[model samples]
Each structure stands twice: as structure tokens, then as C-alpha cells.
Target: MDHDESPVLDALAEYHDRGYLDFAPPGHKQGLGADDAVRRVLGPEVFHSDVLATGALDDRRSSNRVLERAQELMADAVGAQQAFFSTCGSSLSVKSAMMAVAAPGETMLVGRDAHKSVIAGLTLTGIQPVWVRPRWDRELHLAHPPSPEAYDEAFAEHPEAVGALVTSPSPYGTCSDLKSIARVCHDHGKPLIVDEAWGAHLPFHDDLPTWAMDADADVCVVSVHKMGAGFEQGSVFHLQGDLIDPVRLKQSADLLSTTSPNVLLYAAMDGWRRQMVRDGRELLGSALRLAHAVRASIDELPGLRVIEKQLVAKEASHDLDRLQIMIDTLDAGISGYQAADWLREERAVNVGLSDHRRILAQLTFADTPERTDRLVSALGDLTRTSLPAPSSVVLPEPRDLELEQVMLPREAFFAAQETVPVEEAADRIAAEQVTPYPPGIPVILPGERISAGVIDYLRSGKTATMVIPDAADPSLKSIRVVADT
Candidate 1:
């Protein structure tokens, strides 16, 4: 395993050097047919690199094994037993991992705070999910990853379960104790799958929270697009341990993955792996220090409190990612929605995910002193001109908002579903997902028995500009429900 070898990139370079052109699917003939308008904005290099994984990057038969070598290099770089690439992004990678562990109708213990993609997996695979509760910070109004004790309880009762899945470094960067959870699952001869989607850089650095494989997880999925230097839609899943077969995991990914994977993403992933292997710790080391300084500066702002290790003391989470600078704007007399809107419109500084209480400023190694200074100065200006008070958002009490599933997600979703006015949709079983965008976790999963309190929260949240993308109506005036015969 020569760590410096970038097989995908090497092949792509050779392909271009040979001048072997084909008038194939990309009518552009490598930018010849590409429109000037599109080229002016996106540039011709983008088109040049928009190659098919097989025919464009390598020969039709893939004699070079370019992708295979790249995957191995990635695995070695991260210290995982095996690494598999997915151009479909971690959304699909996670679904493939779930399918490999257990078939349809089997039970899997899942953190209730999981991203909507996990909910989508349930719909696709028909896996019964036993929910594990996250510790909710009543005062901060934040949610962290579920505790190990919670998963232990679920496994204790559902001994017949095949495996467990947990989310680490949640959108807000709170992490779970994967080591403890792994021990709990392994004691029962079950596997632990960590959806470390926001933590591609975890393996590249030492000071960050524990990387899944280091904590003995059987399967871990990472989205390189989030924290690594790769094109969007680039994802990889690392598999280890006897509980899951590498062949079966690869088969599952192949089943859902696209045949025409992007060559550019592959090359980027390959390069990132090399960069990390050679110099990740150094890069990430600087990033962690810069993030700390940024957090301290932000905390000095009036009406702002940066969430850090303090939130881990809350119920569910065991750790946190300090790079995710989460600030509670509740004291500012404004909702997170307002602050986000103001920042984007006024200062041209766009934050990441925002909810009722906070706006997250997601930092990466890409940030420099100039950009960070801009962010701090912008926040200071915004606070100085702040308005009188933010309208209080009424959140549903936890018990009232938690809905019950009446049917399998797949059944209620694809079955006879029709739209009903939101006013009348309460208490009616839901047939579609109601999710909050940015973080993209579903608030109301399919087949769930709906409640009035949940509806009120969603309705109000919608009015206040909390994004709910999958609703039948973006306005949420009506909800799709299981139709009657």
C-alpha cells in the first residue's frame, strides 16, 4: 500500500493525456458542446472532470483497478479493516449499512435523534426501530446523542435484535460515548453501527472525540463532504469485526450505489486521504485551536453563550466537537431563525443549522484568521442593532410531541396516501415525513400516529421560518395521510 499513490487521479490524468474522446452520454464531448453560459459560471474544468467512473476514468473493463486501490489506501489511512466508497453520499451509505446488518422486519435499536436518512432507511428496509432517547437540555433546549445506558436497556429487553445504530457528533456537534455503547452491544454478540456523518475528519485528528473504529464499532459511515476536503456527495463506510461480513457490506452498497459514479469525487476522496495521511493531524491541530479562540470571542458577545463541554453534562451526550460553535441566542430576545435570516441578508455571513434556540457556525480546517475575524465582527454588528424582542416559539412538550407508529413506514408511505388539511390531520396517522431541513431529521416519521401538540409546534415553527421540506405543502396547510378505503 503506497500511501502516496492516487489511482483514480492518476487514471484520470492519463485519460486526458491520451486524448481518447467519445461522443457519449455527456453530449459535451468534454466541454466542446457545453454552453458558454454554463461554462462561464462553473468553468470548463468542471466539465472536463465530469467523467464516468468506468469508461471515462478507466477502461470499460476497469483493468487498472484504480478505484479498488484508492479504497484500500483510504482504509489504511483511517486504520479501518475495509473502506468502501459511495458517490451517493452518506445518506445512501447509511441505508446500505443498515440493510447489510439486518433484513426487513428485524429490530434495530436507534437513537431517536437520528437524521431523517435513518428514518428513510426504515421505510426502505422495513426494519423495526426501537427508539433510544437523547438527553434533552431543558434549559438550552438542545438534544445530544443518546446514552449507552439507554441502548443497554433496549438490548436487554430486545435480546433478539440484530444490531444497534447511533449518531455521533450530531448537527450541533454533541457526541455519544461510542466505546461504552460498543461494549454494551458486543457483550450481547451484536454489532454497533455509528453514523458518524459529520465526522470525516475525526480519524484524521487525535484530539477530537473518539473515532468510531477506535471505539470498537462494527460499521461506521463518514461523509467526506462535511468535514473533509472532497466534493459534495462523496461518502465512505468503514467496516470491521466478525459480526458484519465485508463481502455482504460491499454487496449492499453495490445494490444501492450508482453504476455511473463520479470520477471527480473519487479523485477528490483519494487526494483527501493522502493529504490526511501525510498531514491531517497538523492541519486539524491548528483548526481546533482556532475554533477555541473563535468560541471564546463569540462568547463575549451580549446575549450569546457558546455551547461546548457544558452541554455534555446534560442527559444524553458523553462528548462534543468543539469546532461546532453552537450559540444560544435565546437571551438576545430573538429566535435562531431571526438571527440566521438577519446574518444572511445583512452581513452575507450564512450560518449552518438553526432551530428555536440556537444558530451553529460550523468551522473547518478551511477557515483562516481573516474569515473567522469576519464572522466575529459580523455577529458583533448584528447584536448591536438587535431588535427589541423575539417572538416566543411554543415548543411541544416532549411526551405530547412524540408520535406512535401505526404501520410499517414502507406500508403507510407507499399505500393509499392523500392530503388532508392540517387542521383536520391531527390524531390521523401520517403517511409522509415532516422534517426540519439543514439538519434534515424528520420531526414526524411515516406511519406515526399524529397528535395535536406536534401539529401546533410544526405549524408555528413553519410560520416562523423553520424549514420543513418534505411536507405535502411547504406551507404545511395540509398533510398527506393514509387514505381510507
Candidate 2:
């Protein structure tokens, strides 16, 4: 219960003090065996901190209670009844959360705009998805988290659903009305799991989008690496109330989580929690002000519309994360993709989460006036000497993109399947997911009856240089489908 005690850091410090040398799993034993080239690039400190969580940080039996105590402090920091750290990031944490409440073949209400990882969860577990459609802002051609009414309709149809999951503060900075959605879920005795991966900094700042824990989400997964000061892949999921059993959640995480957990990640998580508790509010306050200024400045540029309060318009999202600077490049005669490529290649400014319509700049407490000024200057320069715009990327409309569920995802994924060229695989039931990265929503989730329109869009997307890492081709040229047996 002591907020000041960081068990993970304490144990790590103890291990170092005791001169705990290991001949264990990590071939790079305390940087002694690390290649000089590797140490030069990654630094010896990284290898030194990569000690075994149990064998090195604590003892074999873990009598020190290092992880357990660290989790408790994290829970306290976020006002959650329980918290579990995951080195594998929120992607794994969210899957574990889904399986904890719902089992194979059980129905779970899910937002259709979820990350590709959620679709992966569906394919892995046999959970039947009851899709809750996101509030699509057709004008912006962007997807926001589903409104409460959308989830209400979904629950009305599948009242027997075990739980609901919503991705609030969607990658584009749009947020759902989680408080109302939570009330809706609680009224039906269903737990609400918020994929709040980009919301780790929310709790500390009042002006930011409401944190899931504060909004009454029963289970909230957050990536400490996002909007927080931590190493990449640092993630934690917090839970409160009787809707979800914390013990079951921990057990579920343990089943999917890695056995050789990273002590460096745990220490970073500990350090981040302490930093946030001590100075997050002040740091975030400055970042918010800088974001507002930057957004206003970006708006003055030709053909650049900074999607800010424009997102909060009742016609769009219910709420918005102000720090998310979404710049629409369509008016500039360039696709968001083109603008992103040009900016990065020309000015060395990389925007986060680019889509056909917009490039999103994810501002964090780490952002400063200097960095934002650089971004604004780059954009200003980009539009001035622009090359010919990219050919129009034919994006599928909200309806055209939606696929018909022909079979269960698990069956289609695991059942007899054949590989065919993507061009010829249209109209066949998709046996694998073909999703565009960046927003990472699958265009072709397994078991869905693929449409020609969707295929054309994805194929065209690939031609335009869309990153589809999960696909067999990454170019969406080949497709996997249930074979005619």
C-alpha cells in the first residue's frame, strides 16, 4: 500500500548490490558476452539491466514479492483495484483481458474499429464477435470509437454477451463516451474493457481525455510507452469492481505472457509510475499548451486543416484528445500518405498513424516548443515545393468495407485453406486477415465473405505504399482462403 515503495526497482537495485551474476538463459550475461557492436549501438546499460525477473531480480521463489508489490503501487497510482504489468505490450494484455471474461464460442461485444490485435484475439480464441460499429465521420473519412448508442444497440441484440471492449482515444485522438458506455455495460452486468493503450498519461491531466479507470471501465489496458516515459513495449492493464475477477485476469495474463519477463521493462514501468505520480500533471500541462499553439499554427498553413475541435463537433466524436494533431492533407492535392512521405523524406519529421486522409502527430509530455516548431516549419516547407500528388487511393466506404461473417474466425483460420493470388481470391471466404497497418484495423478478418470492392481498395492501398505487414504478401497480392475440400 506504500506508494513510495517500487518493489521492481528495489529488487533490481538489490540484485545489482548483491553482485548477482547469472549463467542463465540470456546468452548475454551482464554485458560480458554482449558483442562490442551491440553494446556500442544499444549501450552496455541496456544489457546490464536485462536481468532475469525472478532468478536475478528476486530469488527463485520470489520471496521478495517484487512484481506483486510493484503492481499494487501501479494500481494505487491509477486508482484501480488491481493492475498487472505486461512486457509484451497492451496487445497481449488486451487479448488476456478478453479471454479472462469470455471463453471460446462465447459472444463478446467488440468495437469494429479495434486494433488488428483484437481480430487476432478472435482468430485465436473462438469468441463470437458482436460488432459495435464506430461512429464514422464520413466528412473526415476517419473512424472514432463507437458511440454509447451503437454499443447499446449491439447489447440490445446480444444481451447474452459476456462483456464489451471499446478502444477509447482511437489512434486518431477521437474518444468514446466511456462513462455512459460503462453505465450501459454495468446495467447489463457486463464488464467494460477499454483498450486505452494511448491513454497512460490521461489520469494525470484533467484537460486530457478522461482516463478509463476514472470513467468506470472495469478493465483498462494502457501502454506506458505511449504518452508516458517508459521503454517501448511497456504495458499495464488495470481492473476494478466485481464485474471482472482480478485473480482470473492475472491467471489469463500468465497463460499468454512470456516466462522470461524483462527486468528492464519492469524497472522502467516502476520508474514511469513514480515520475507520473510526482510530475505528470505539470509536464502534461505544458505539453497541452504547446499542442494548442502548434495546432493553431499548423492551421494557418496552406491546404492543411488541423483536425482539433473539428473532431469534437457533434457530427463527429463525442470527445477528443487535444494533443493529437491530425492534419488533413487532401486539400493540399496530396493524400495523407503522400504528405507523410514527403515530410519525412524532406524534413525528417515523422508523423504517427497516417491514413488515406490524415497524418496524426501524437504529442506527449516529451514534446517541446522546439520540436513542435520544427514540425510546423517542416509542414510549411513541404506544401511550398510539393511534387505531383499521389494518385487517388480509392478507400472503401463504411459499408463497402464491412464483410459478411461466413464462418467462425477460428474455424476459417485453422480449417483447411489454400493460398491464392489476392486478385483471384475475391468473393471467396477469407481464411486470414489482410489488414493495413498504422490504424491496424483488419480489412479482411478471417471467416468474412470478402467483397470485390474491399479487394480493390486493399490492392490499390498496397500500390499506394500502404504497409500491410500481416498479409502473406504485404502487398495484398496473394490471399489465403478456405479451400474447396
Candidate 3:
């Protein structure tokens, strides 16, 4: 139970110290076989660490159980009964979580503002989703995580639902009232699966919103790469309580997860867990202070407003992660997309998530005062310079945005489908999800009737350079819809 022990890292170190030869699938042979150019640019250490999880990270005999110890350490680090690491990121972890709870043809309550990955899970499982409506901010054209009252209503309507899944601390950092929502699910004798992908650091900090595990969620999936020190694609799903079977969770993950996992990712997660356990309080405290200063400074800049107060309004989110410094770019006479692009292209800085009216700057334990100063300076420059506003996306009225679902996502997506011009696509059943990336919430989900308002929003949003990566036609000149019978 010693948190100091990083079994994966220790084993990798021993492998190097013992000079073990690997005739493994990587074919890199511990960087010796790597191309000189590749090694020169990437460094020899990357290839050296590119080891096979089974034969290289652990012995072929499977006696060491290095990953097992690492997982145990991780579970212990976070307050979870069990934890499983995933190299495939939370996308696969969430899909596995969904499958573990509900099967094909079963019903589950899901947040309508869920990420594209969640929709993909519904498509793969064919689980009938009873969409739980999020608290929409009409003034901002944004969606917050659904309130507990919404879940209570959905469960009342569909008591047959096996479970519920909610996304907490949405990419913009608006959090759901998980404690109340989890209580609502438990009242219905169903488990709650929280997509807390943006809240990995919540557990380590007291000022942050409540972590799902602490809030009684049965299964909570977190992306360590997002808020923790782990490498990209590193994720961990935690489970506490008897509501969800631990064995089944592992089985589901095994079905969806890769056979050859990355040792580097495992090592990074192991190391990050140690770092957080040892000094996360001090580190995150420093980050919180810096964020406070940054937020005040950004607010002082003319024509720029940092969004903190509105996020926690009574009708808005239950909590907010202030680490996500969301700024309204509208007053600066540009769209969030334009500000984000200008920041990256002109100032060599990149913000986290950008939408029609706002740009986000994510502060982390890794951020320093110098870096924050640079961000403030670049944003100030943006405020002073006048820029033409980006093309506007047609904002749909709340009523018009609610398209009726005609079929299960799987059926409509795989059904006979054809592309039709944007104008002609109205009233046709959508055969694919059209989402604006960054936040990655789908405005048009498969199986829903595509309304003219939704179509116009997408087409105009695309014209303004919104990146709709999931659409069958990214250009949005035409859309894929279920063909007429």
C-alpha cells in the first residue's frame, strides 16, 4: 500500500539496468534498432520506453503483477474501492462503463449535452437513451450540466432505465450537482456513471468541486492527462460500492481496451499519482492563487470579461472549476474561434476550449506566474486591436433545438442513408452526428429529425470556421440523412 512505489516505473528501470533484450512487437529493440533520424528528433528515451506491456514491462511468466500493483496504488491514491488504468483515454473507458451497466435494448438516462464519445457508445450498444436536458443558458448560447431535478424527472418517466450517465465539469468547467443526482439514481435503484473526464484534479483539491467518487457515483471515469500530470491518452476509472460489479467492469474494459498497452503511459500515471499524493495540495494551492490573480488581471483588460460569477448563478451550474479561465470574446469584437486562432497564430499561445462567444484558458499546477503574465499580455494585445467579428452562427430557440428522436442511433446511422443539400435536409432524420469540436457536444445527433434551425446553425457555424469534425461532410454543404422509405 506504499504510495511511493511505482511498480511499472521500477520494472522499466530494472529492465534497463539488467540489459534485457527484447525480440518484441515494437521491433525497436530498445532504441538500438530505431532509425537515426527518428531517434534524433524524438530522443532515444522515447523508443527505449516503447515497451510491450506483457513481455517487456512484466515478465512473460506473469508472476510480477506490476500493473496490478500500480492499479492498486492508484486506487489507494484516489479514494476508490477499485481503479483500472486505460491507455486508450476516457473515451474507451466511458464506453466500457456504459456497457457494464446497460446492454443493447435496455434504457439508460443520458445527458443530452454529452460529448461525442458518449453518443458513439449509445450507437455501439443500441441502448435507448432517455435524454436528460441540461440547463441551457439562452443568453450565452451554452449548456450546463443537467440539474438533479432533471434526472429525477427522467427517472420518473423511464423507471425501466438501467442507469444514468452525466458529464460533470463540462469542457467549459461548469459542474453538475453530482451528490444530488447520484442520490436520485440510487433512489431509483440504478447506478450513476459520471463522465468526470475534466475533473481528475478535483480529488486532490478542497476548493474544487466535489469529485464524483466522493459524491457517491458508482463509476467515475477521469482523464489524468487533462488535469493531472499524466501523459496524453492516460485515463483511470474508479469504482466504489456494490452497485457496479468490479469483475464485470474489468471484463468490459478488457473487451474494449487494447491488448498491447503503452508502458510509458502507465509509468506516467504511476508517477503522477505519487506526485499528487505527495504534494498535490501545495501545488494546486499555488495554481489556485495564480488563477485568482490571472482572472482579476484579465477582467481589468478593456473590453474583456472573465466569466466566474455567472457560472455559479442559482439557475446555472452547482459549482465551477476556476482553473478554467473562460473569457467572453464578444466584447472584443471577435468570436471565440477567431480569438483562439489569433492567439495561437500571432502570439504562439493556445487556449483550451473555444466557442461562439468565449475562449478558455486552462490553468494548472504546471502553470507559473511568468506563463500567466505572457497570457495576460497576449490577451491585452488582442483587446486593443480591433478585428472584424467572425460570421455568426444562427442561434436556435430552446424549443426549436429539441429535435424529436425517431429511431435508435444505431439503426438510423446504419440505415439506408443519402446526402442532401442543407436546405433540403430539413425534417429528414439525421444519420450522423454534427458536432462543433473543442467542447465536442453534438448539435445534431443521429436518429433525430434535422430541423432548419439546427441546419442553419451548423452551416453558418461552419462558414465561420467552426470545426465540425464528426459530420459526414465537414463542409456542411450537404448532410447525411436517413433516406426516405
Report the number of the highest-lDDT candidate. Answer: 3
Which digits, one per residue and each the tens of the lDDT, describe model 2 over residues 1-485? Answer: 66667788887777778887688868888898988999999999898888888777887898988898888899999899988999999999999999899999999999988998888788888999988877667777777677888888889999889999999878888888999999999989899999999899899989998899999999999999987887888999999999888888989898889998888889989988988888888999999999999989999999899877768887577788888888888888887788888888888989898877689998999988888899999999977975775766777778877788889889999989998887788789988888787878888888988888898888777777788898877767688999987
RMSD vs true structure, all candidates: 1.4, 1.4, 0.9
**Higher-ranked by lDDT: 1 or 2:** 1
Candidate 2 lDDT for residue 121: 84
Clash totals in order: 2, 0, 0
Residue-wise C-alpha lDDT for candidate 1, range 244-319, written one tens digit per residue: 9888889988888887788889999999999898889999999999999999999999988887767767464687
Query: Where is model 2 poorest over a 10-residue stretch in terms of lDDT?
Result: 386-395
Quote model 3's TM-score. 0.99
Q: What is the C-alpha lDDT of each candidate?
A: 0.88, 0.87, 0.91
Could you tell me the C-alpha RMSD of candidate 3 in Å? 0.9
Report the CA-based lDDT of candidate 3 relative to the real structure. 0.91
Please state the error at residue 59 of candidate 2 in Å. 1.7
